[model samples]
Target chain A: MNGKYRFLLAALPLAVVIGLSGFFYDRLGKDPGELPSVLIGKPVPEFTLPGLEDGAPGLASADLRSGTVTIVNVFASWCAPCRIEHPMLTALAKVPKIRLVGIAYKDKIEATRAFLGELGNPYALIGADVTGRVAIDWGVYGVPETYLVSPGGEIVWKHVGPLDETVIRGELLPRAEKLLK
Target chain B: MKFLLRLSSPRRRPGPFAGRVPLSARDPGLRRDDARGWRALALATVLFLSAVPALAIGVDEPMADPAMEAKARDIARGLRCLVCQNQSIEDSNAPLAADLRHIVRERLAAGEDEAAIQKYLVDRYGEWVLMRPPFEPATYALWFGPAALLLTGVGVILWRRRHPATVPEAEALTAEERARLDRLLKDEDPA
Candidate 1:
């Protein structure tokens, strides 16, 4: 009995060390800022908001269900990262069969128009979410979040920050092409 | 040793005309003055620290009714600030948190109860918006895991105490070893 208890006591530290090491190992190579979206693989939440441009029809959830993959970008004129990613978004607009829609989050229409005028508008349709209500529906934490919605209206992928050239070329394009296939 | 040395040292006279005064008589006021200064400094430090959160983060304008304002504060405290993950909406100065606080106040003013307001937020941001997760199947482990671990630890300790380990039987000594042990014991015995 003494020997058995001693053996068990000896195994306890080894078990604890292994458990802690496994936990840390799992954390390694993972970005702490990359929070998993709870809405992944789920249908896009319903929302309808006014358009940013004059007389343009506002975007609705039904508009995204047009049997084509849509890239929905949530941005604001005041957000610095949105400005950085605007050019990349412009480049993305040139890609054939890619439907890019922009949601102007919590920004004035005039400011958004000015921002687009200076930066060059890449969005096919721009929706003004003045109250940020539409953004909340999409589970947007902050500005410059991008979502890839499937043709069937499911939110396929979500990127939290500014999309650089590398990310656009490496991740977005590949994922978009995969959805197209 | 340092205190003893100081105690043994002779006091220095203030002037040629004056006799040596005891250290306590001369320095008691100085010590009291130093202590008073420190106490004032500490009080100021505490006050500054306590005032920082209020000054740093400008909360939204309070409702006219004190009870309504308190309810808004309670609701805000329970909501998480998406921009600042660790801070509640009540504590965060982030623009998004400010917007959420405004929404909460608006909802409360509209006579919407706390549950309905929280549900509105949860429908948008999912349950992650709640600072305290609701009691649900998904969160059962998170809520009960620590207590379960504690109980398991106590049970293991109690079991170990109740079923104490017994020493293993020892091997019998050989005749030669027994004779040597007897001789050594006899040699050491004064009686």
Candidate 2:
């Protein structure tokens, strides 16, 4: 073979091997994007957070009643995926059987209020988790995490990431309905 | 697309240019000129586009969207921490790393484009901030060396398989080897 062709032949296998390794490395290193709940089947963390809506009295663990299925959503004004998932939260609010509440994780009141105002508040009671201690207790790695709390205050399921219409309709509602029954 | 591909592709030149400049008397003026030219280019690029100050402007003020904060964290996790090698900004606790994380959040809340945000960070911290170093002459080995090594290894294995080493089954034993074996066995004998 000529010099250039020989060089090309030598380079081709090297390129192929590298491309294959990179493809596998990317595939193997990728985060599965599913955050498994450490709080599953455990009691919901006890917290007293200031309410976002009426600015009324704060919400506490005692507020959760038995026999009702509630979705406690952790959100912040700074989370974009929360915005993506807001419509789903709003739709879930209209479902009478499911009580949807929002926890404003480590965010200021003004920002939280503006965010809700623009997105349309779907939460029955929005709690300000100012210090993020409550969020940490709930094992929240990031915002837009939702937990399904049984009437008995037992956290039955958690869905990490944004709650889209598909997630709410498919994963949350079906599981909640089962809990309610 | 071609620009992006170029940015992502690793380029290696194993020619004479790849070696470091030897500080010898040979072509001293020319080598000095080359080094100076590269230094000037790096400095000019750093100075012209550095938007480091823009990171601090909007953070002190309260944001209108708290949700963007979470998005910022997600983006930061994807971003490599400039000051700390091989660590994502979200996972790093260094003061500059923290500042970078806060800046990313602030910028995201202010509605910065992802590419622009990445570029802004790169301009401030240089290409080192990027976890996946852009394919360039300097980073060619980091990106493509392993594959080259693997190919070479496979080639060696194939060559070894095609040209197996010959061995003598019986005549291989030398006189000295036979004497040593006999001595070893005699020492260990029960009799």
Candidate 3:
């Protein structure tokens, strides 16, 4: 009985050390900022908001469900990172069969128009989310977040922060290509 | 000069040491200086105390109904500010947090119940937007992991204490082994 207890006591410390190491090992090399979205693989949240341009038709959830892969970019003119990713988005717009939709998060119509005017408009349809309620539905924590929706309008992938050439070439293009297939 | 000398001197005043001399008996100039210092401190303290309430009340203006305002505050306290991440919407000064607070107030005024308000936010921002995570299957380990570890540790300690180690018994020596031991003892004890 004592031998059994001794074995258990000896094993406990080793077990704890191994367990802690295993827990931390799983977290190693993982990006802390990359929080897995619960909305992934789910249909885009239903919302309808005015267009950035005056007199243009408002965007709706139905607009995204057009039976083609869509890239929804959430950006604000106030966000510095959005400006940084503008050129990349402009380049991505040139890709065939991939519809690029822009959601103007918490930005004014005038500012958004000026932003698009200065940077050159790359978005096919620009939705103005003036109150940011639509942004919350989309689970947007920060501006300059991008999401790739499959033809069925399910959010397949979401990338937070500004897009760069490496990310564009490496992650965005490849995921869009796979979805297109 | 005599008053200045007394003021500058380290001479202990003779008495059952009153913690201080009467201001009137001391140098008038020094007394006036002390009064000015105290006034400045009091003014600063009043300004500081007044400023605190101003800042707190400035962000969250009271609603038309006090009950609705209180309910709004309660809901706002539970919502996390995505911009500041760590701070709750009620506590954060971020523009987003302020907007969320405004929404909460508007919802409360619009006759939405607490649960409905919370659900509205959760639907928009996911479960992470709540400062206190709800009790659900996904959060069971997060809520109970520490307690489980503590119980395991206690059980191990208690079991160990109940079964103390005992020294093992010596084996019975064979006749040849006993003879060898006797021979070694004799060799060591030789005069």
Candidate numbers, best TM-score first, in rank order: 3, 1, 2
Winner on DockQ between 1 and 3 is 3
What local lDDT score does residue A120 receive in model 3, on the 0 to 100 scale?
Answer: 95
RMSD for each model, in Å, please? Answer: 7.0, 19.3, 6.4
Model 2 over residues B1-191: C-alpha lDDT tens digits?
A: 22332333334212375337442234445444555556666787887667554443333343456566556656777777644556887676554466666667666767797777888766434565566678889999998899999999999899779978657486677999999888888897745
TM-score of 1: 0.73
By DockQ, rank the candidates, best first.
3, 1, 2
Q: For candidate 3, write residues A47-166 as lDDT tens digits.
A: 988987568977789988989899999999999999999999999999999999999998989999999989999998889999888887888888889999999899998888999998
**Is model 2 an incorrect, acceptable, medium or high docking prediction?**
incorrect
Stretches of model 2 off by over 4 angstroms after superposition:
A1-31, A53-55, B1-191
- Which residue pairs in model 1 clash with each other? none
**In candidate 1, which residue ranges exceed 4 Å CA deviation?**
A2-25, A41-62, A108-119, A164-181, B1-57, B163-191
Error of 3 at B144 (Å): 2.4
Report the Cα lDDT for residue B157, model 1: 99
Report the number of the highest-TM-score candidate: 3
Taking the true A–B contacts (Cα pairs closer than 8 Å), what share appears in each candidate? 0.47, 0.00, 0.47
Best by lDDT: 1
Per-residue accuracy of model 3 over B1-191 as CA lDDT, tens digit each: 33343444436333464437764465456555556556666898999999986776665668988778777888888998877888889889887788788888888888899899889878766788888999999999989999999999999799779977567899999999999889989897765
Q: Which residue segments of model 3 deviate by more than 4 Å?
A: A1-17, A165-171, B1-41, B149-191
